[model samples]
Target: MVLVPLLRGCVQLLTLPIHVLAFLGVWDPLCKTTFPYFMSRFARLYNQKLHKEKQQLFSNLADFAGASEPLSLLEIGAGSGANFQFYPPGCRITCTDPNPNFEQYLLKSEAESKHLHFEDFLVASGENLHQVADSSVDVVVATLVLCSVSNVQAVLKEVLRVLRPGGAFYFLEHVAGDRSSWIYFWQQIYDPTWKYIGDGCSLVKETWKDLEHAKFSKLNLQHINAPFNWTPTRPHIIGYAVK
Candidate 1:
């Protein structure tokens, strides 16, 4: 009886890749309708662990920007508006995502909250932020976003365009790792599977190099080993830069 159950588990694990591969070429069914729902639910569950890091990053950004409350902030690729929940009080926050489904949960959450008021939610992409005015934003935050953007260089240019002089752009991202043969071997095999299931995430992006090439003013890069409750993987390179 135990052998039968164990064998079933093993089979399920083996077949997960097939399911993931099917979803790769096809647009994510989740992105169509269930994306926001899944994101909201997952955010609530994952927020406790992830939010602390986000808050810490935000604090660092505030210090770097030398701004207090009531600051003009833009969060590009702000899925499900998780950042709003952690933002400092008395701020006019603008959160944008390409997915329209994000409006329901994001707007609803803000409506019920007294402190975190959102200015708007628009359908926007990082590569091209149309509505945001140039040199108007004090701080631009991108957390775990670049790996999936279609054009990273364009996105940085857009970010640089929007940010006010002496403003900060903060990031928390995992990049492609060093030349560790073991890590490389596994990443090579499973990268496709991971990207398929986790949207357009890439384990091979040289995030640090890209940022350096972008020539953002006063760039500082830091690497922190992200807490892994599951399996060991590459360390995340968290970045903070001024424009």
Candidate 2:
């Protein structure tokens, strides 16, 4: 009981500088510029660690587009195009991210992922994908995104709106751990600071619950621990939902 408050206070003290930068209105632009660079480097290791799980999650992607048509994929929060390698051959991918700084890194990833076809890189948020037409995509992918979205339900709704009938939505997201665990307790203590430092990511988002109620015709989701040293990001959910 006593340790919880002490830990929370320590987290707040550690993040005081970030809060000050945010108050001065320097944080957003600074984060937009620096985060993409950091993610470009970090994503390589992250992709390697989760390679097997990502392979299994994406194995069925080619089936979604059928034998004749090329797969059309829209990836929300597609930072640095980390998942590009996992996508099946001949996939026409449209990537969206709120931070335009990622375009350079995404282009580099696209160049490397020759098996996949590169489309447009849209500067948009998952909640409002107005640039993308309704029911136009064969697949919508969101990895480690739901945690940061201002409205998870709205993002899910937009996902449903943009996916064609029988189209699939694949997701792999870090989520809150069991309430009784010490990790969950620490997640609560660290979340506020984590959000600012992690570019609005929440350590305690029970995203599975929102997915459950999102009206997907077929939801095949499961919980698993990701191969991350960071405890808050270890608890994850991976699977796909079909419209």
Candidate 3:
């Protein structure tokens, strides 16, 4: 008797398993390739308006010592240089990122925000930025960085140390959800797994509390809930503080 052969197949569970796979570096290539493309697209859409609203903050990022010198700005975790477009014209920038995967993206964004001048790109982490001198920069920007860092206090102190007496530290971050809400509980529960998969982002960080204690000369902060962003990380803060 002859037997017929049957086709074989297995079902793949896409959602739940991706978390573990991403934890294993399986998603590194996709993250590196896709991040810049999405960042550029989003920057172009919101940068102009964001700059317009935050123009005063950007304008304050200047030195009057001599008109010949452009304002110097240092950004920690400058992923893809996405915030460059929001800076004032001719402001000189030095970008640093822990992930060198974004080197090419930074170069691309360097051209898009042509008004600002890029001085260099350093491979560095936010927790330690010793290469930048104390009170040396007119401004320091950190967007969407603190939650993933090893030490938020250390990073904030570094920002304060690098900024000139009157210089400003501008930041935009998605902090933890309200403590009273169930979202906060979920955030806490998912933190370990999320951090492992989402590049060390602590979705439950009460980052504003830290900023308040950081002792900025003057801090002006506002909390916002951004629509369409992931719920656990939707509690946002955008502000500037003088060092």
lDDT of 3 by residue, 76-95 (tens): 98887767756778888899
Each candidate's TM vs. the true structure?
0.81, 0.96, 0.79
The TM-score that candidate 2 achieves is 0.96
Best by TM-score: 2
Off by over 4 Å in 3: 1-68
TM-score ranking of the models: 2, 1, 3
What stretches of model 2 exceed 4 Å from their correct place?
Answer: 1-3, 66-68
Off by over 4 Å in 1: 1-30, 63-69, 229-234
Residue 97 displacement (Å), model 3: 0.5
Whole-structure CA lDDT of model 1: 0.72
* Model 3 Cα shift for residue 204 (angstroms): 0.4
lDDT of 3: 0.74
What are the Cα lDDT values of the candidates?
A: 0.72, 0.91, 0.74
Q: Report model 3's TM-score to 2 decimal places.
A: 0.79
